[model samples]
Target chain A: MSTSSDVDLDEVYSFALDLAKQAGKMLDDAWRARCDGGPQTGHVEKESAVDLVTQTDEDVEAFIKQEIASKFPIHKFIGEETYSKGSSKEYLIGKEPTWCIDPLDGTVNYIHIFPMFCVSIGFILDGEPAIGVIHAPFLNQTFSACRGKGAWLNGTQRLPLIRNPIPPMPQDAPKGCVFSCEWGKDRRDQPDGNLHRKVESFFNMAAEIGGRQGKGGMVHGVRSLGSATLDLAYCAMGAFDIWWEGGCWEWDVAAGICLLKEAGGLVTTANPPTDPSTARIEDTKLGGRLYLAIRPAGDTEQETGRQGQERTVREVWRRVRHLDYPRPGA
Target chain B: MSTSSDVDLDEVYSFALDLAKQAGKMLDDAWRARCDGGPQTGHVEKESAVDLVTQTDEDVEAFIKQEIASKFPIHKFIGEETYSKGSSKEYLIGKEPTWCIDPLDGTVNYIHIFPMFCVSIGFILDGEPAIGVIHAPFLNQTFSACRGKGAWLNGTQRLPLIRNPIPPMPQDAPKGCVFSCEWGKDRRDQPDGNLHRKVESFFNMAAEIGGRQGKGGMVHGVRSLGSATLDLAYCAMGAFDIWWEGGCWEWDVAAGICLLKEAGGLVTTANPPTDPSTARIEDTKLGGRLYLAIRPAGDTEQETGRQGQERTVREVWRRVRHLDYPRPGA
Candidate 1:
């Protein structure tokens, strides 16, 4: 088992970045071919009607997996396509250095030629996110991070893109915040279903600031862009103030969480803490399945980045309904 | 008052394209300045806390208005910022050569540094869309069209960017469609309010194909990108299969409608027609605050583009709730 102290994180980060770009090129070529050619894009249903998988997805994942194996044969890999195929005998994150990949993060967007899809590669060691690389070929953006080394955009600009003084979180947060969320593929209408809770929660957050019978946080705006990975990347860039999501696997968010952490953002359980005052956001787990992510904050007269994030999280938690996304093998 | 036949649409289209690019440059400069500098990017609340107006918005609109007045001295102009002010004695769309401009279409996105915002310029002659141009600087996309002429991307590639044979709409209609919508600034929570109806409609569309008890369309996906103009532009390019929106004024959609029309798409009332049998999608009024836009359909064995669009519209109408956004002068 390789620990963070013993792992060459810089080497892993460079390898991950190269592999992500290669996967991105594969995705771009397939998308362009689909546009120039015909309906031969070859997509099939996965778990449900809305859930989809494409040949390009498989091809990209295979390429990334082969590259990783050839370069670092000892490291384990967990990819979306392979995991979905029921090949996860040891799916649980062990102490060994592991790689998590989502070859095509937004497949539906890709199929429609919407230009929001990307290839994400994340490396973890000692059960902690260590390096992440996400490349969006269509959007011409690449985000990468190495723990304790900070995040970068296109290997140049630093994360949060905004360089000036960061604005402090408003006292009435989730009020002036730009909230990002997604309506996942699980659309069951039952009382406790993911769809029902998501709709209720979105309504509460978007309703009038004081409405919803005191449940409204009235965040500045709610965006559903259909890609959890990109949402996290944007949150890391300070474009999205907060991102709340569930029903997504580790591949979907692992790289994003790494980027956010390196960018000085906070990640926590999507569900409210039982004891809000005593809860530590740093205790959040990678495979938790439900996550709340808040971008770095601007320092104010009284609030530090950590304090602002905690306050904003509390306000957001008060508005969102309790979602049930049990951990795998729980 | 000039009619479409008499107006030189090509000239207007070229001018509109150049102006859109200029506006986009202005927006990009202001945005870059904000990113590099501090909180000097002056902004104030408009209509509601969620609604915002920034100095760049006003500056861009003023610049566009000046350019239009100088280039086409006889043309009328209506801009978003100017319209928001109490200077609308001639706000109503009349039978004239008028330019409808949303200098900064997605102000909230611009303020938050989201990349989905754009500059939209639409030319109307005799109450009909004649020329349109939408430029998104951050995304490096420029969409333009002239009446009776095809739409283009960055002045080169023809729209519905897919050059291969188009696939006909599926028999299931919205079942496999990529639906685009928005959560407008109206957040009232009353049963008949915009927010309540929007939430209900989103849930119904996203629910399982059979779980919503005959109400579910089980659309492939739902995206809320927050910019009606870009949504319309993307629809023209065939990235978005359908765009349903309310609470957006003519400026937000005029240019997009022109681009879609030129690209072989369709725009109809967002509300379900009172007489579905007698309804003609072509008769949809531009002043109508609610709109339903469908992208160009793929050719199939049994359907043409027009037929496919009409059929898809009917299916989507059945699933979406009626939204009331009264005409400006009604």
Candidate 2:
């Protein structure tokens, strides 16, 4: 190993890749088996439907947990199914090199058979996200990244989309932009409801001419694939110019963050859209309870300095300033 | 030809299926050619940024028009690209057979290389949507239906989703709903800006407990695939519980309506929320400048009669009551 804090990075990455495929097969089989049973067959077992979790989610998570423990032995694990039951949040930061697993990132999409969901796994080294592997079995696409070595799609193409730099920006005219957000898991209708605020802001960003408050951002469009993992992975490739959301966890974004960062994309709170470089890796875990991510500019847009990525992030963020939400449960 | 209708139903259905694939291939090829070329490559020629049209759209439309003219000879055609330039709208409601082609639906999604776009072709006989075919090459799916023959997917499975009927409703509270909507092409920020009204209403359907006038439907989730063709096709299969949209034309919803009807789904004006059975097929074109579609209730879940589908439709519509938009220039 390179240092005492290090594990064999490539070896762990390979293990993650294999584990993800194994889990994907299980999930897909469950999906196909229930396909003809109608939309409700697979969606029955749930924690208040909207924030759905099925038998398959737990089955897949348990499988991955068993496999990871058998293989890694010493690594700490923080998985979505077990996140609430254990002290995994304590394992999020530290030199223990935790592994974050989201067995199924888009459960809602899966239930509806909308064909956009994936399995995401991230390896954190000494508290810094270092390796990420995301696999969408239905779409037959996989995205993975190693900290310094670069990101890859399906084992070949580089990330930040097409492994190419973003296209050159047209002068003056705000570069045509696309932003994505989610309805999220919290369905509270209270005055402090998060969705109410999100819906208002989504309208503000997507409306034409001038949006709410006479300032529509006029983005090309907005999308919600119902999966944070795929969203972050697509954002890494620049497919989605920007993906900002709240109420998702590290498991949802950890793997994607590796691919995103390794591809030279930037991430910050969905609100207060700040310079991503300003935060330390460990200390940067959703201090604002939201995340705003942008693909680096290249001709596929070029990345100049903090200004390069920040300019687009700041520009888009200006229109969505209305999305700011109060701290959860506060 | 059957009866005095003088139309060969199967022959026209075959013609539509062939033309859809031909157009789908051309669209797919153009999509691949422009994949790595940033967002603007395929979107070079456009009416506006958000409401985009590429060279492929025109080329594909022209190709379909020529092929239909040469083979069908006497058939009238209404293709989106040529709609504004000619008197095609006059041919929309006629005893003569007319082919409505959306050369490229979800143009925005296609431009972004997002994989959610397709070619939709529908044949209307005596003003009744008879033959329908929608091909999405990237997804390797083709949905088609004939008035009495029923709908099919990939040329094998019956439409209305799988070969199976709509699932029976669960005994529990509600078999969580999954609804779909569109950002649409209209960008006017005015009160007539259907999008402004849509945004406010979408929030209402999606919010929970009490939202926007203390009435939230709390649908299982919401989706915006940005493709009306695919949205309707999926609704026919019961994939999306409900899809509400406006400002879209006949070509957009025509083909899908055929499949939905064959699948036993329901379609009505989005604003007034009328009974599909009471409306004439020709008069049923989202004349209110809107459409509300629902998947047929299957034995899998029995919510009962018009009330079954209407309950969900009315529930969601209550939140969007303010979304009334004027016809075009009004």
Candidate 3:
């Protein structure tokens, strides 16, 4: 197992950035072709009818895999397409250099031409996310970050794009905060199912501040853009104050987590911490299927950045129902 | 009172387009200033706590009104900011040529820097929408149209951006259809309230096709971008197959409806037509509080574009709960 010190972070980040852009170009070409009267790109169901996969998704994954192999032949890889097809259903993230990729993160958006899909590539060292890159061809934006360094957009702008001092989380938070969440492919509506819980939680979050029998959150706004990667990326950019989701794989969030942390944000499990006093952002597991992300905080006389983020997380956790999503090999 | 023929639509459209772009620039400047450490632009509640209005919105609206009045002094005007403050609560759509404008649509998105807000301008002649222009500053894209002419994006690409022959609505749709809807500011969750109905309808639309006790529409995707104007414009662009909503004013849909019609799309009430057999897209009321916009359809030997649209609408209507929203003067 190689330590983080053994890797040249600059070279890896540069390579990942170039690879993400190349992959984005391929996605753009296929999208343009479809829009320009090319044969319709048919899709097939993956886990369910709502979960979809397309030829372009597979092709992009294969292309990315080949390029990485030629450039870093010794590095291991865990890609969405390959994992879905592999006979072994377990994910192995050992303490070694590995690339975790979601070649096409928003497949449904891609098929519908909604212009929110993207390519996400995350590099893990010592079983922790070290470098990340994501490119959205339609939006013409690229976000990248390396551990201990800063996050960036289009390789220029330091993120949270708002360079100004951010205001501390509102006293009545989850209120006056722009929250982002997704309706995952899990549509089972049983009383205890994730879908039912998600719907109830969403309703509660958007309800009047004192409505819903005192359970209302009255969030400033709620957005579901159908792309988890972009959702996390936007959270990192300070466009969203909070993002919560479940039923997503490690590849879905590995890159986004790195970007958010580099931007001075925090990531924790979607569920409330079992030991509130000891809860730490560093304790967040990469393969944890449920995740909650909070934007960086503003320093003030009464509270520091970490204190504000922790308070906001606790407030948000109380408003949401506990969601359950089995970890790989659990 | 000028008839459609009595007005010069080409000249009016040109003026509206230029005005929208100029308004977009102002919005862009203010946004950049706010991001670059300018004093925070404070907001106040208008109709409710969820409904907000900032100084920038008022300034932009005033600027647009002045530009239009100077260019066409004889024309009437109905701007959102002015209407919200006026003594007369009734909306009067006389036969005179008029401009209906929403200076800053998606105020929440703009405040959050979510990049989906826009300035919308619609020209009404003969009591009908004749010219439309919408400019999204952050997105750097503009949509425009003139009656009897074609709709366009950025003055070059034809509307729909998809030149290929679009496929007809699927046999079981809202299934396999990309649907767009919004959770409006009305967050009341009473048993029979619009908010409750909307939540129920959204669940039904996203639930599994065979689940939900056969009530599921199982849409291919559901998007809530927090912008009514853009939702309708995307419908015109053939990206969103269906967009249903209530609680939006005429200024919100007038420009979008014009763009949709010019792109061969259709607009009808969100409620099921009183007499399905007699439901005609041309009969859709501009001031109707509820709306459902459908994208243009492809030609086929068996079904024409209109037929395809009607079929899809009926399918969608049955799957959603009936929602009630009062008209402006009701």
Q: Residue-wise lDDT of candidate 3 within A1-330, one digit each (tens)?
A: 455567787899999999999999999999888878897778999878879999999999999999999988878889999998987666678888999999999898888777789999999998888899999998788999999888998888777877688767777778888888888888776777888888888888888888787778888888888899998998888888899899888899989999998998899888866654456645478888888898876888988877888888877776778898886576
Model 1 bad stretches (over 4 Å)? A1-6, A87-91, A275-278, B1-6, B87-91, B275-278
| Candidate 2 per-residue C-alpha lDDT over A157-256 given as tens digits, one digit per residue, 9 for 90 to 100 | 6665443435433232123666778887666666745776677667767766554566576777788777888888877766677787887777888888
TM-score winner: 1
Q: What's the C-alpha lDDT at position A281 in model 1?
A: 63
Error of 3 at A52 (Å): 1.2
Instruction: For residues B77-176, write the lDDT of model 1, one tens digit per residue.
Output: 8888888886443347789789999999878788888899999999888887778899999999999999888998888878887857765676787888
* Candidate 3 per-residue lDDT over residues B1-330, each given as its tens digit: 445566777889889999999999988999888878996778999877779999999999999999988988888999999988987667677789999999999998888788889999999988889999999988778999999888998888787767688766676778888889998898876877988899888898888877677878878788888899999998888878999998899898889999999998888888876655456655468887788888877877888878888888877776777778776465
What DockQ, on C-alphas, does every prediction get?
0.80, 0.49, 0.68
Best by lDDT: 3
Q: Where does candidate 3 clash, by residue pair?
A: none
* TM-score per candidate, chains pooled: 0.96, 0.87, 0.96
Local distance difference test, each candidate: 0.85, 0.72, 0.85
Cα-based lDDT at residue A209, candidate 3 = 81
Q: How many angstroms is residue A242 displaced in model 2 relative to the true structure, after the best TM-score fit?
A: 1.5
Instruction: For candidate 3, state the interface root-mean-square deviation in angstroms to 1 decimal.
Output: 1.4
